[model samples]
Target: MLTLLLLIPIAAEHKPLLLERFRVIDAPDPATRAAAIATRADEIDLVLTNGTVGFKADEIAALPRLRLLAALGVGHENLDLAAARARGVAVCNGAGTNDDCVADHALALLLASVRALPQQGAALRAGIWRDALPLFPHFNRRRLGIIGLGAIGQKIARRAAAFGMVIGYHNRQPRADAGEAVYFDSVARLAAWADDLVVATPGGAATRHIVNAEVLTALGSGGHVVNVARGSCVDTAALAAALRDGRIAGAALDVYESEPRPPAELVGLDNVILTPHVAGWSPQSIEASVMNFVANVEALARGEPLPTPL
Candidate 1:
């Protein structure tokens, strides 16, 4: 039987299927993670981890027989891609598995920020009348700019159309399939041109801090920013400064610089909307993600191509 190192948390319903297929060794918890991983290092043929709970290089070094490394989510930033490549390990991720969930969450954040939902709720609870609070920007008919035009961003655009919003995007190259949507070659230019900026790019060194003070400045005081991508893509300190100085109107973020902990700088700010890094998490999404993992490993066993190779 093929041995597997299950680093990412597997749901109860899916656990039995995976356990039955392979000699699964669980090491997700802190207490058992290191020793468990070490004990089975040489025997593990495949390792499963997530972007945040990424498998390390030293851990990779330990697993001499490791044939595959898969991230349960779209991001595999924490995984040492170079090292994996050097060792001829194939990498894969649950790319399209949770696109809808993440897109829906991004829309929720944007609408909440645009409508001042939190502030409105706070005022109502504090006994303030509706007209006493300042008016919020209308979400409909506004210009929406997405940083990445990948699978999730396309879904976000599809949702945005229902609100009668005009869409623009920034990417390395213009996509012909984007149809009527305008494209910006640079993120800064996109921010300047857009009324609201949405980040949908992946996390990693290439994208780290791509949305910095300069981009925020270009976004102007009337523009709002939304990040549904990795926290590292945006500079937290720069974002905080921009919000505090009113350089940007507002921000809605599902991910931040610190994983597992809220961004300390933005948590106290009224102009920003914060959520736990659950933009891609849902019961349905998780099920789909696990299914993707199962398909990848099973394909590996059959000597066939995986569904979503990273």
Candidate 2:
């Protein structure tokens, strides 16, 4: 028998069968998370955490029997990889499990921001016709630039093409499948060329603050921006300042630097839309992610390499 602490609640509806083999810990707070680990240190053979709230090196050292660290999603940005590697503990993530859900949310945010749907809805609820208020813009034939041509970005591009938007992207190396879309060598150049910019990059020190004040300013006053990736990919302070001074026309975000809590600077901005970091969440995706974790765990127990080791 093994003891495992789940950092966040998984989909209860899926009825994970591994429950009988492990003890589940629901730790939503720092104190509670640490407390659970401390109390069950010796018995915890596995630790379950989302990509964002990863297990620390010291935390790993505390648990003598920790054999695996299973991340709930593709991102393991906050994970202590070097420490885990040094300890010889296997690290696995739910790769490709939630990409579709996140891509769907990204497109939804992009459409809403560009069409000014929220503002339009609010005006209608206040008994003012759209004609009386400022008209919301259309997205037809607009140039949509995507940053980072990864799996999620590719999915977004496919969906955007259906809406009649011209697609372009910036990446480290040009993807052969990206033949349908134009490729830009630099992010700043891509922003200048696009009427709207979508960010789908990974997070970490390498990509931190890639989208700064200069990039936002280059997007210009009539340009829209959508971020469905990591919050650190774009500087929040720069984004908030851009919205304030009309450096960019509008912005939509589903992830932030400080999650579960919305940014204080963006709270009152009508031109910006904010959501809790739930871009990768959906009924189907949640179920698949849990199943993926279970499969990885089973593989680890059998001394086989994980199907999707991160």
State which candidate has the highest lDDT: 1
Model 2 has how many clashing residue pairs? 0
Candidate-wise lDDT, in order:
0.89, 0.86
Error of 2 at 58 (Å): 0.9
Off by more than 4 A, model 1: 29-31
Model 2 worst lDDT run, 10 consecutive residues: 9-18
What does candidate 2 score in Cα RMSD to the true structure? 1.5
At residue 33, candidate 1 shows an lDDT of 74
- Expressed as tens digits, the lDDT of each residue in 31-121 for candidate 1 is 6779876576778898889988887777788888999899999988888888888888888999899999999999999998888898888
Tell me how far the alpha carbon of residue 276 in candidate 1 is from the true structure, in angstroms, after superposition: 1.2
Q: Could you estimate the TM-score for every candidate? A: 0.95, 0.95
Clashes of each: 0, 0
RMSD values, in order shown: 1.6, 1.5
